[model samples]
Target: PVEIGGGDVGVGCDERGCNLVDHHRVGGLERVRAAVASVLDVEVTAATLLTPERWKSLAGSVGSVPVNLAGELVAASGDGTSVVRFPAGTAQVAASDVVDFFSFPGEVGGAGRIDRQRDWWKSWMSAVGSGKPDTNLPALDLDVIHLLGTVAGGRVRVPVGPWTGGEDVPTIDQGRLVDLVVAMFPVPIPQAPGLRPTVRLLNGTGDRSVDSAARQAVLRAGVELVVVGNYRSAGVIQTRVLHRDPADQPAAAALAAALGGGVLHDEFLSPVTDLTVVIGSDFRMDGQ
Candidate 1:
């Protein structure tokens, strides 16, 4: 929980949008909130389903402080001073460090109520399959975790006391921090038994012969190679695996895992293959 002190911070909205106000003027907290919220959303329904025992366990593990912002608890903080505990670390913030806090709507992060319901059911089924109580679940909301990091000032570089040392303190990488938060929410990908989907390799990185090297690695992993070609966009940076059917997601996920790391997309353009693997500049055959 970040302990906020100093600075008069409040929430306000206008023609532009919601913003953080400090002594009747705009401040940095709104920008910080938007920057973090743009990439994440806290699903309140999923959070609500967590039993008090489960919440306690998750808080102990991740150091999250789940509080209702609309309740009297926030009012008790007194004049924009509050403590917000996030997963990354604890911080002392001023009123200028915080904007208004609110709950996400039923539709957030392109996921609606139905999608959340389906996810909840899937989570329940997974727990039942593993013969574990629902209380043992990991925190499933990435947005909430990211917000915690944001409030904890995980994205920005701040002075760590007086530094009279040899090496300068490294700036925190927001991308890596988000990735760490993502790693906390583990979802079970279903794989089809005895199914080896054909892979169409595309070189998106424009690197010389990188696709050829990747092909060898894929072949070593026993993934079937249907074709090798150049991707439409040469500027693509991250390696990705696209599957034609939802049922083949596990195959795509397996192929991605075997190849080190890759984002999975639900779009297959190839007529002959069930999966399309694009090799980007970030990809290394050695998994570096």
Candidate 2:
């Protein structure tokens, strides 16, 4: 009926939090309400859901494997009864299920046990910027698809390279390198102001080189690295991304993804940092 614009947060899972059991069992959703507030620059007390289009797609989603992080939304009709997606890749749902999909974690963006929730918003803008156009997703639903595309396209510029150092690495430590782990297709990312999360890195292996490489990887995650130092114990065998605040889980997820992988933990909440990444000896770039 009318095009409305407001601060509405959509949480997603691959299956739309619509499991036969544990309906609310969304991954990494502990404090997502707050993390999303930081992400959307809104005072979000709760998540906003869509119906029919996005709802049914997410709820009735069949595959457990994660699709593109920057999924797709095919058609946005003017009458408001259009189909949608987490980002919009495969299905078109009913208007009623739109909000229901939003209720599902697959629609939400961030970390979790499932690929749907893990890194949902990570590749959205890049996917949208391929110079390819979707006629159905053009502008009729500017209220929804276009707006989200614009916001997602404004992600902070962070590079993904040299995390696992090699001779091929460039001398320049200032720009982004391709992270094959997260994105199969790479696009130049834009900027989103005032929402950058903070991070801290601890060298658990007691290896300065490991610390150096991880710092390089932070460029990929795009979050501000406030601290880079040592983990008290060098005995750590595996890297870890730790945050005490549930609100920081999103940041932890992003960092973990950039580092290729890490043991994500909700413990060790710190007033000084949003996330602490303890670099383990096991840390290595994918396929490195």
Candidate 3:
């Protein structure tokens, strides 16, 4: 099973930090899936990264829009004849509510507005004075659920046991797997679109025999292998790098270099700590 830790929210578009915060590293199963698919030259699905500017733009759009009594979202065209109205009953929560959810305090310039919002919650009684809600809006637990969904999508095949995620455990069909990879990366494959993907196994069991065999598998598949840990049994090493735009050679090259160079796991890559190469049962998996 995969465990997706709550993503860290911080100010700025610094991709390295944002990536760490977004769980690019230690992102559990999501990271593993991306790495494996990237290596095989297969497509990855539902992989998306939103910049802070984009988040702000969404927030701005939400602010200008008004919520009607029925909580419907209505957008009017510049021309008098056009109007787009979203039905009220379609969503229990307003679009603005969703937008506001990403308006995290300290996410922009570290101003800490999101924390201020939390503080505001504590002061609700003072602000309301004697006035109480007509309907009970019981204590909501933030720990029980998250308001936003993950941005990456893909699947992983572990050789040993049955998968752990509930809805994620659809028997892996070739077509569905292909679709998922396509959706995640949404990019054209390299010289060979028909290329069967391969993965590098970092079984650093410290036995030359085991390492040699794994190396043979990689060479047989025509891929690179950089081993660490126990070459005999298991070890975690930089494995895969996904390519979004095959045409973007520089980007693709940089990604490859990063993976080969272990940039993602580099502690110096970001301030987020403990970017360790974890292996075995301790590792968690998350499906998009």
Candidate 4:
């Protein structure tokens, strides 16, 4: 059996069945289920719910013990089952095991990817707060959950903190939660269209190697490289896409999309090439 502990959320599972112990009843199981499916790459049949006390008792009976979620803990028993125990119930899925317990924070992207995800989440939250329709935001959350779930194998859980109704539910905003989740489990950049854009790559950062790395990334994404050099400035922190003509905006967007983050600028009557990509220090060559 696998035992997981997070804030107030607990999970215990074995090959025969599984259980979830949540202090605050919210809508996270569906997300958990999606994570499981993504990790295991298989359909989940069912799960048996149990009370916290009952789950604790059962866990104890099976040599399970609570541990601090200070960092990350992964344990495997002689039976070949793995259990990931965390204080906040934030554990990734394990690769193998008929029975496993896992939990993860709301945000899952690591290092360089976190900032971009945070910005993306902020944009969406701002739109939502402005009373604009954010139908696609929910899908993005699911996408992140699914991706994290797949990494761990089908057994994952997330604690939604306490629920006191109204504004007392949690001080942290949902956008922040999304940021955390994305930080923990970054999504893959979507592939650019086959109609590749001719790109002029320039390294805005002093790092000379980034230009070469960016070229390979652009090429892997099926984009054509017209020129490679250094930018006029060396202080760019974020990538940017400049199009000389309005007609090439789509091409610039496609190239930017492949790089994951960038601001598209219309240079209008400039005499540059088709598309230009200014690689900044924040440009991630590892992809995530």
Best-performing candidate as measured by lDDT: 2
Q: Which tens-of-lDDT digit does each residue in 208-234 have in candidate 3?
A: 454433333233323322323342345
Model 4 CA lDDT for position 83: 65
TM-score: which is higher, 2 or 3? 2
Candidate 1, residue 87: Cα displacement in angstroms equals 74
Question: What C-alpha RMSD separates each model from the true structure?
Answer: 17.4, 17.4, 20.5, 17.7
After superposition, the stretches of candidate 2 with alpha carbons farther than 4 Å from their true spots are 1-194, 285-287
The TM-score measured for candidate 3 stands at: 0.22
Candidate with the larger TM-score of 1 and 3: 1
Off by over 4 Å in 4: 1-196, 268-270
- For candidate 2, the lDDT comes to 0.47
By how many angstroms RMSD does model 1 differ from the true structure? 17.4
lDDT of each: 0.46, 0.47, 0.32, 0.46
lDDT tens digits, residue span 1-288, model 4: 111222323343331122222312233565445433333333444433444444333233223323222344445678989765433333322222102232222322231222222332333233333332333122333344334334334323343322222221222344444333333322222123224566777888989867656766665554556677888889889987888777877777777787876757666624555777888888897866
Clashing residue pairs found in predicted model 1: 1-84, 1-85, 2-84, 2-85, 4-93, 5-93, 5-94
